[model samples]
Target: MVNRVATYPYTTSMIAENMRLQVKYSEINTQISSGLKSQNYKGISSDTQYLLSVESAVDRLEAYNTNTNIVLANVNTMYEALGQIEDMANSMLTAVTAALGGGQVPTAVTANQASNALDETQSVLNMKIGNRYVFAGTNIDTPPVDLTDPAWVPQTSPSVVNSSYYQGNSTITSVQSSESHVINYGVLASDPAFEQLFRAYNLVLNNSGSITELTEASGLIRSAIDGIANVRSNLSINAKSMEDQIYQNEQDKVYLKELTSNIKETDIPSASVQITEIQTQMEAAYSSSVRILNLNLHDYL
Candidate 1:
């Protein structure tokens, strides 16, 4: 005859407990391996709102940082272009000064040099970073200066009556550096200094064969050199401001990342200890369940 010991209920309870312990152990192991408390928002039930807020803040800050980097790159490009232009202006001034001091007439060689300098200045003014012209002010899609077109005339005379060769508007370009800060780091090709340089070069290229014209051009070149020097100084100041803003943004990002990590990242040491404990419990439950199931009247006898 079979022994009627009510063992079925105990076996069923042990099986349920074993399944629970095994699931918990697997979850802990996964968390320890992945080093994240939760893979998704649904799994992060505790402090879910706070975690979400921090994540959103981090995302915004990352976006701002990306924008700042792009703007900084553009600013650097502008600075380089300006430096090149300044160097070109200084060379032109020196050549013209030497010619005036020697009382030499401007020759074909001088005209060629002036032409090359003018072309290079125009090219730099129309320089593009990506698809946008860095010196175009608000008209980023348009070239700032167009010296190649024969139909184009100088709109501004020596007295600054109207616009110049630059086709762009007067509006300055600004970029968002941070939540509270915006930077106006843009320079226009139509700036008075650039206008003076372009005009002086044009005059030299056109009438370099005459002594009187060459002397007049030399004076203008000297004035342009001084003007360009002042603009370069201002640009240097703006570049430094951009650098400081970038540094501050990086610092803020570090703090924000740390905050997000504290909210979302798993504690590896604690998770490891919990996983070991759960694994031990599961092993014990399995052993106990197997022994209980194997027991029968024969063992008792």
Candidate 2:
């Protein structure tokens, strides 16, 4: 009988190789199933800070998007209200023009129309969105205009007219459109355009028996209409700017998400191939281990 002194070493080598193959197989299998390079930052230690920075940028852009949406809502609402006020001004202008052409003073009909327009304009300027008044500037909770306030005395001259009816402050609202851009987009009830409108309407209401005053009111209404048009133009520009920013934010978010995926997610097809290769290696190792274990000096003899 021959003594096989190297049999133990061969068996030990095979056992060690099998253990390595088993561990590799399990790792690849888990990787394939989970579809992530690593579940935690520690798994992708080198990219942890970069990933956090990208995610933070995405969060900031999301915040800007949310804020811009609110500003756009307020701007659009103000635009619509201004349109209604423009219509009211045109109606009052028409009434005043008729009185002027007929060589007569403004009657009760013109005065009542002026009064109704004043009331309606007050309601429009005091418009609120989600409990905050749109035209109130920084005084978001307070009504911006109150023509019915007894303390709001009417001005007699267009040159001296101001937003006496405005109860809001001069603080302008601003929005962060993006990382590099901030937009000052607030329109207060005290804006000169609104002031002109109120002046024209009040002129008609307070001087219904005076032809000269009615003619002056007609010109004032025309100026107010032009001023309101300019305000609408500026607001429309702001709306467009915010809309463009929102679109850019959406596209940026998509790019950031793709970056996140690249940093954290595994390539499924590549992982599958690796798992198949490991499985083959494991099978071969198991077979070799069995052969080593079954080795006998008698069989060789």
Candidate 3:
């Protein structure tokens, strides 16, 4: 039996060209299967570029969120401190308005109550949330008034018994909002409100409960207390606004994540189908290559 010879010429150029075409098709199929245009660093360009960038920006966005949260939390500390100040102010005013008599009350004026009030004022200055100073102006790490740090206050007395001495700088500092705007954060101890209240402390302490001094300073301190309350209200409003923004940002972040996933993330089902198609084509090319390479001079004999 004679075997029929088929005409076949497998030149280097033809073989090389066929190999290139097969490899190209295989790559496209592999890409579809892997759900990626580029598996290694070399094949890295595609629509996913933007998705990768957005994912990277999440780190920065999250950092901004952290700062915004800190500001909101610090506002809480300020409110609590203001409440303490208000309580002291109200108590002092009560003592002043109440008519003191020999039988009912001690005639000798005691500066002790005023002293405690001054102590409360110090607390307002030294307000801290966690380990950070909430009212330290720009000095976040260092206490605004270092009572024990030995830098600002060398053996500084926690109790400012002498209200005549102003506790802190009157300058006010603000905090950044979650929206990148500045908002009034908290009041400084040297604020006008505190100054007026301090006067009352001085009057009561210096006069030693003289009804005349108590009455005069009472009005000033009461007004100051009211002012502080106003400031506290403002801060609360600002904090609530920031909180709302943060919540909104969180939603936005979720949406962005979804967008990135859709753009960049690979689908397993689609990838599997692509891989199977590429394998079929590759096998066909391999068979053709074997048939051509098998042809020899003996076929013409």
TM-score ranking of the models: 2, 1, 3
Cα deviation of 114, candidate 3, in Å: 1.1
Which residue pairs in candidate 2 collide? Answer: none
List where candidate 3 sits over 4 angstroms from the true fold.
1-42, 46-53, 99-103, 107-110, 128-133, 139-171, 177-179, 290-301
Candidate no. 3 TM-score: 0.71
Residues forming the 10-long window of minimal summed lDDT in candidate 3 = 150-159
For model 1, the run of ten residues with the poorest summed lDDT: 154-163
lDDT of 2 at 35: 84
Q: Per-residue error at 70 for model 2, in Å?
A: 3.0
lDDT over C-alpha atoms for residue 42 of model 2: 95
Per-residue lDDT tens digits for candidate 3, residues 94-123, read: 766652333344434346777677677766
Candidate 1 lDDT score at position 12: 71
| Candidate 1 structure lDDT | 0.77
* Each model's lDDT: 0.77, 0.84, 0.65
Q: What is the C-alpha lDDT profile of model 2 across 120-174, one tens digit per residue? A: 9889888988898978888998999987677667656443665667888999888
Output the better candidate (1/3) by TM-score. 1
Q: Which residue pairs does candidate 1 place in steric collision?
A: none
Tens-digit lDDT track of model 1 for 110-173: 8888889988999988888989988888898999898755644532223232234778888888
